[model samples]
Target: MMIFEKVKSAIDMKTVAEGYGLHIDRGGMTLCPFHNEKTPSAKIYGDNFHCFGCGEHHDVIGFTQKLFQLNKPIDFVKKLNTDSGLNIDIEKTPTKTDISEYQKRVNEQKTYREYEKNAWQILCDYLWLMREWKKRIPASPDDDLDGRFVYALHHFDYAE
Candidate 1:
């Protein structure tokens, strides 16, 4: 979906841009981010915003991606369209580049998710085994008696 379409359909363009640190003032105009400016020459016209200071104007999706230096404009568009109540028509057909990149991302994300799931399962199984072993074998005097075993396990597993 085009950013223009998304922005034009949404009502809270200025609020959304402000949430991204654009600092809209004087009816959604702010200092241009593309160039150094003391005065606010930027203007937001309904869904689209423009900066006369640097002559940069685009829809909210473009503004968001440029402001945050996102890698993909599509990613930002998808996010904004999904989160900010901007409805978009689904593409009837996908292009080759879109299909290929989406497939690659699906494969990578699947592998990563599977790895995480397996790792979590392994830890859970290990904890069950440990609990069983502990039931079978009484705690020793030298064993650290603090109930921090689960906390330590969680910290080690998820503290990325």
Candidate 2:
């Protein structure tokens, strides 16, 4: 079994949350920590938790990671092993291939972000030009330029 499966089998999310001092009711409900709520909106299941108030959902490992701000999954696993006295073996060092793949994914995300930024800028500029044209163009019922401009503006407004 993988490390994730081992951790999941070893840890109960409800117990972990209780260890953090969050009061969980017998019905498996608690006040959501991620958001402000008068009533219990976070529900804990056998393997995971979901908050209806903030929509925060995660397994046991993810719960600990978010709660303690651990940087990586391995870090969380190590912490869990230490705290729970589990003998799950995990590699302490990542391979070169792993580092390369991580860097590639990071680069791809950066490129996608740049593309989205440029696309939004272009859309905003086009919307501005359409507004300026609407101001300069005279109101003519026969010509549908005004109507088309209005439609374009509405489309871009929602798209942005």
Candidate 3:
């Protein structure tokens, strides 16, 4: 089984919350840790927790990730195994290098999208400028302004 599934099945959210010093009542209500609240607004179900005060809801794994500020599931599972004595294998898990490479690719794609958007906006502005120049120039065939506007349009097209 995957580490996430294994750890999730072995661990109980209420027990983990209590271990973290949260007082859970009989109705599965506790003070929200994500936000300050005088009344109990966090509800702990069988393997999940929901905080009404903070509008945060998460399963056991998500709860652990948030509570400990962990960014990876493997780290959360490892912590659970060390702290709660739950054995979960980590041999087949993806390495940090793979995750970093994926993140880099995503960032590159976002940059390219931004570049494309800017290029499109520049093209639109140039087109609008050309239309406005046409309106300002006289109807005579020999108008220097018309030639200059055409030259500007041609330059912008080549630059793009």
Candidate 4:
């Protein structure tokens, strides 16, 4: 396998960020080292980082390169290997089973991420609908309140 591929496959960005003294919260966010900010804007994924505030985006090696002001990616790779003790065998060739396992892992991660995003979006939409329902008050004292409003009253807090 190539050095770049081997390095990326072995080392996760969270480890790199943590090793460099960046504290990642439960949401995988940290105060961006690239810029000064009161709140954490950089989202660290397994492979990369994206800063919502400054529009800075980079993969693991790119991040390390920028963080250290290195001239070349190879230099960053070397640092990652030697300093981080990743111990990725740069010249090792992947077997068929190794390739299949890696692909399977990648696919599973992609599927899980998609499911998580979809679920979060669905919950947010449901919350909004419940809030809208709660606003539907009856105009007359004798009239019955909207059932949706009652449902919202019962479930909004719990759902939230």
Give the count of colliding residue pairs in each prediction.
Answer: 0, 0, 0, 0
**Superior by lDDT: candidate 1 or candidate 4:** 4
Q: Can you give the TM-score per candidate against the true fold?
A: 0.43, 0.51, 0.54, 0.56
All candidates in order of TM-score, best leading: 4, 3, 2, 1
lDDT of 1 by residue, 1-160 (tens): 3444434444345645654567666666787777898888988776677877778877777777777677776777766655443334334334556445544543564467569869989888766755544444326877765454545444544432
Looking at candidate 4, the ten consecutive residues that score lowest on lDDT are: 101-110
Better of 1 and 4 by TM-score: 4
The order by descending lDDT is: 4, 3, 2, 1
- Cα lDDT tens digits, model 2, 1-160, are 5677666665677656765678888899998887889999999997788998899998889888887889988898778656644444565344555445534544564467569869989988977776665464436766656665666556655644
What's the C-alpha lDDT at position 125 in model 2?
A: 90
Q: All candidates' lDDT scores? A: 0.61, 0.71, 0.72, 0.82
- Reference-based lDDT, residue 105, model 1: 49
Q: Pick by lDDT: which candidate is best?
A: 4
Candidate 3, residue 92: lDDT: 62
Give model 3's TM-score versus the native structure.
Answer: 0.54
Model 1: clashing residue pairs? none
Instruction: Give one digit per residue, the lDDT tens place, for model 4 in 36-91.
Output: 99999999998899899999999888988999999987889888766555544456
